[model samples]
Target: MKDYPQSVRRKDRQETDTSFLHEILDNAVSCSIAIEKEGYPLIHVAFYHFDAANNDIIFHFSKHGHAGDEITDGKKASISIYKYGRLYTAAKAVDFGCEYQSVIIYGTIRIIEGEQERMQAMSDFFDRYFAHIPDSSYEAFTAAQSKPIHVAKLRIEQWFGKEHALPAIATDAFFPAFPSVMQPREA
Candidate 1:
């Protein structure tokens, strides 16, 4: 594995463990991919497969969509996958923060065009999300359903992982504000 460029802003929070990076990718249900097009940055949420074997990510987009139109082979893109954690509060406003594990990947996108490879990538994607189905029927089903889908592989050139955590000590009579997901609902 090659060394990724470190973020000078938060050197302490950068994560290097490859296992932790895989965990974040495997556990995430969706990712945000940012692509630059004509001086504009377009970000879209997509369902992706983390190919640990190839050290890349694969995803599908609708044919004739903005992604298919804007993104092509060798295009540069950035991917972000994250897991949100609890909010951390402090007596001082500047100290307030939140816990999170996130990874940013810089890569060149490759559009899988070969019939065999495209089908295989599509199969891998379906198998990841639909593991319950047996392989006997998977091939036939995928072949029939894959016609309208376009698959692209993001070949990871570099990536950085970061995690922010609060020290395990209580502040002086301070109450931490909970995240919206953790807050109670109103009747």
Candidate 2:
């Protein structure tokens, strides 16, 4: 519920806007979830389900991982999604640079208990990753996998973002206003 300005101040070269943030969430199928255990940082890669409607994130893992165990305990986890925006440049006579957008979400994890919540979260994941599935197959496949997976929801506390631009001033919807920075010249 907390806005970007109230959460944490981030410094980056990319303009964090609404559209850019949405794109990063769209392009990414999985997210790297970072948590801490016994004072050490534990980061695990996870397939994520995002709800743009309420800006919520969902993830599921077997009862195995330490992250699942250490999720609550008054500590929050961080999840990030990014893309490799590599390209070649002709005028510069070199590869200019890769452009990318990323979103960092801070939230508390709550283990999903009811079948309804779990199935709904799974549905979100299915829509994002398997949008191409045929109607019958999709329903059947979901029915099969639904009972097997244990879904959990991440209640977002706050969020922030960063990204790269080609012209350095490209505007987007999900990202915030990116301040232009001048790289320091070597003496």
Candidate 3:
């Protein structure tokens, strides 16, 4: 890898801190994956887990969808995860904005193959979303009855992270309670 790609328009908002990227991923439960098939563009929204240990984006999808067969290694893919923060309103309509933390990863998608790895990924997914279940129940279900699902991992080649925070100086004067002007305001 490369770091940030040339695609992000707002260069000033780009963040390089590894922890910031992890933070965004940690807080997000869903992501939007973009792929191309048959010379057309496609995007899929799915639940995901960010495996920081190996820097992988893990997710499961139905085995019958277009993704099940197309999302294989050596294929280009991109995933975007975001956290919504407070809305940022400016006195000027053109300056209206919002606070957020987001990460976009561009990489190759790999469908996990081995049973053991698939099981481990399943366990991680279960633990992440249903940690309250009794350990015995969880283990038995995963170890014995869990059928193989289509789990895919994206090997990140380049990533981008950006965040928006309201400046401390931002006050009521900057963000009005109502719309700026009923008419156009110069930028």
Candidate 4:
């Protein structure tokens, strides 16, 4: 990873372990990318695959979508992935905070070209989301590739990981568990 100027205010919450960063990237469900388009911020959320081999991130969008229209080749962008945990409550309102782990990647985007590379990139993306399915299922993905989709890769130049967590034991400062799923309401 290229060295970038440190900007995180809380050094205690900053994480430097490469393995931990990789783990978060592998498990994060989705990521948001921020780009500057015509002096305005354009943020797009999408499912992505962390390309460990090339140290890049891969994603796709409809060719007619806003992202496809605004994202030019070699555009500078930042990607963020995060997971939230418990919400900690304190006697002082200012102290209240939530547990979270996140990574922010600064990189440049490239629109992928050529049939073979695009097919492989999309295939890797499919496997990341549906690894349990058999190879035969890939036929469906292959068929879908004919649609008007723009595949792009983010070449990572720098990245930083940060986390804030609470102790396992409960204390006066109560930390409520964050629900992973919402329950259905019953009459």
Q: Point to the candidate with the largest lDDT.
A: 4
lDDT (10s digit) by residue, model 1, range 32-144: 99988878888878899999989989988877778878878887888999987667657776776777899899898998888898898877877788889776874465555
* Global lDDT of each candidate: 0.81, 0.67, 0.78, 0.83
Instruction: Write model 4 residue lDDT over 1-187, tens digit each, in one string.
Output: 2445565888989997889889999989899999888778999999999998899999888788788788779888899999987776666666777789999998899998888889988888878888798877545666355468888999988898999887444234444644446765557
Candidate 4, after superposition: displacement of residue 45 in Å? 0.2
Q: What is the Å distance of residue 4 in model 3 from its true position? A: 7.8
Between candidates 2 and 3, the one scoring higher on TM-score is 3
lDDT by residue for model 2 (1-187), tens = 2333443343655445778777777778788888766778888778987778877788877655575566653456778887755342334535355566777888877777787777778777777778797887633445456665557667677666776656433332233334435856557
Highest TM-score against the true fold, candidate: 4
Residue 157: error of model 2 in Å?
Answer: 2.4
Better of 3 and 4 by lDDT: 4
Candidate 2 lDDT (Cα, whole model)? 0.67
Model 3 CA deviation exceeding 4 Å by range: 1-7, 136-148, 167-187
Show how many residue pairs clash in every candidate, following the order shown.
Answer: 0, 11, 0, 0
Model 4's TM-score against the true structure: 0.84
